[model samples]
Target chain A: MTAAAADKPKKLVIIDYSGELEKTWATMILASTAGAMEMETTVFVTFWGLQTFVKDKKRITGENWMQKMMSFMQRPGASHRKLSKMNFMGMGPWMMFKLAKKYNVAKPKDLLEMAMAMGVQFLPCQMTMDMFGLKREDLIEGMGEPVGAATALQLMTEADSTLFI
Target chain B: MANLDIKLKVDASGLSCPLPILKATQGIKTVESGELVEVIATDPGSVKDFDAWAKATGNALVEQDSADGKFRFVLRRK
Candidate 1:
């Protein structure tokens, strides 16, 4: 590799704070695509976006009654994510998934799995977790750890290719 | 089909954008460096996507052709 090319980092950082189904799919698609392109990719999930990391598809437990009720309404995990528009109370996400399947396009969860297997960094937001009363067990397995603002700052500032979605 | 030796072949026909490229990359990695991999895709976007992916990943897009409504791309791993 050329010295200049080797020195330059081909990293893409994504701040995924959107909770909508379409938005989540877009983030996963981009993350997987970038990883395929040989770019080091990181996805920082915060606020509603943390739902992507929440394994709500599996049986979930809450710390307390309020947490349980909240988890019931706002389950964390990719499978139960909702759509931002045309949700029709939930039909939108299902339709989108069906369409993706019809076209042989990978689903959001599959793309996310592929990206994770490819070594894309997946981080939860510590402060946001504290605010939401979510614990580590509420998230998906294999996500290394929760990160703070400073880590996001460094990654965002250092990366020439960064996306806010 | 030409008599070119392909180390790997990925059929991405009927798939959409990003899937084609993603599958192509997966196939590329299975072969040794400098080996060739061919991707068969029906997505119209594969033409430009493969070209750009080749340039970005430092691979060689040795041949790209569309025949019988299928887009074929042969790439050499860098």
Candidate 2:
């Protein structure tokens, strides 16, 4: 093998498909950790995962009124995400956040911030966004650009490790 | 080593994996190539994390010690 090939940084691609807070917490941690290791890391946000990237809660109304209402009723932004199990109507994430805090575990929001600060790429899935009727304006800042499944496919193909969460 | 005059000392205590390494790596860039930086962390994962970090970042893990589950690491920036 060529020296250049041996020296190339490992690539990590994480596909985030759910909006559960615990799952998101792990995803961001992995992204930031890989990025800190000087690896090329990309987190592909799709489907329900897109909820965590919404900047404006009210503007998330998708194509139809029902979808809009559903989106609006759900959480928005990094901090408001809920856990999938034992959500207790949102108390589960709160308790988990407190527990994580007590144990000095990095909060999901802070992890995401660190991931961005460390240059880990955040790629949004275009087809999922279209299917959900989400507009570009609905997303949070620092979301690099909207890309189709091809981007995720390429990342998965080239990555040394790929995680689906 | 304790005798190594560290130019930058980071109290990464209470910080988790990757953060300790992240802080150390970020701090390492501020010093001269050969200067030393010390890190203290509570995360058990830091032991191996710092080793991997030093390797990946081209820094040298000059010294490492652990006591009471706390970890101490010194690196020479390169």
Candidate 3:
């Protein structure tokens, strides 16, 4: 590796496509850890993954009936996300939260805040926002301006490491 | 113990994964360069994590030890 390259902080880019609680938790963990490690990190959230950044934790989002139905089934927001497996009618997430607390692990909300505090960037997908009929106000505070797939791709090209979660 | 002057102490016991390292990173920066930062962590993974962190961040790990389920590390700021 070049000396200049070694001296510069490593850049990491992550693409989040799933809104499942487990995946989002993992993504947050990595992002925050990378920030702690002094890596320049960015997370691009798209499709269902964007739900994790919604402000309305329990309410269904979207304008059209179909979009509303989808939101109703899955809900929107970080706290409302379900496990991809072993959900067990919501008991699984409850149990997971208990375990995380017992282990002194930061919760999803805290992790998101910590990542932001550590300078990790969160970019929501513009195409996904329009397709889901979501406005910028619908997202959580401190989100980066909406950008398309090309922006994410450009970031990936420049990043030293890239992850699709 | 008395000879090694520690400029800062980070207590990360009961925390998980990245938190220990995260707190250490923040703590180390508060001290002047060449000063020592001491960290106590309960996470078993922190041993290797700190090793990699020291190498990656250019901090020097001066001491590492474990006792009574806690891991201790002394790092000299770069």
- Each candidate's B-chain TM-score, in sequence, is 0.94, 0.92, 0.96
- What TM value does the first chain of each candidate achieve? 0.88, 0.89, 0.93
Docking class of 2: acceptable
| Per-prediction tally of clashes | 2, 0, 0
Worst 10 residues of 3 chain A by lDDT: A1-10
On residues B1-78, what C-alpha lDDT tens digit does candidate 3 reach at each position? Answer: 557998899999999988898889889879998999999999999999998888767778899999999999999987
> Which scores greater on TM-score, model 2 or model 3?
3
- Using DockQ, give the best candidate's number: 1
| lDDT per residue as tens, model 2, A23-121 | 888888888877777788999999888888777454455888877777778856778888778999878888988888777778877778878888899
Fraction of native contacts (fnat) of each candidate: 0.55, 0.36, 0.48
The per-residue C-alpha lDDT of model 1 at residue B50 equals 87
How far in Å is the alpha carbon of B8 misplaced in model 2? 1.4
- Candidate 3, what DockQ? 0.49
Candidate 2 interface RMSD after superposing interface residues: 4.8
Candidate 3 lDDT tens digits, A62-162: 89998888888878988888998999999999999999999998877788888888899999999999888888988999889899889999999999999
lDDT of 1 by residue, B1-78 (tens): 678899898999998988999888888888999899989999998899988787667778889999899999999888
The best candidate by lDDT is: 3
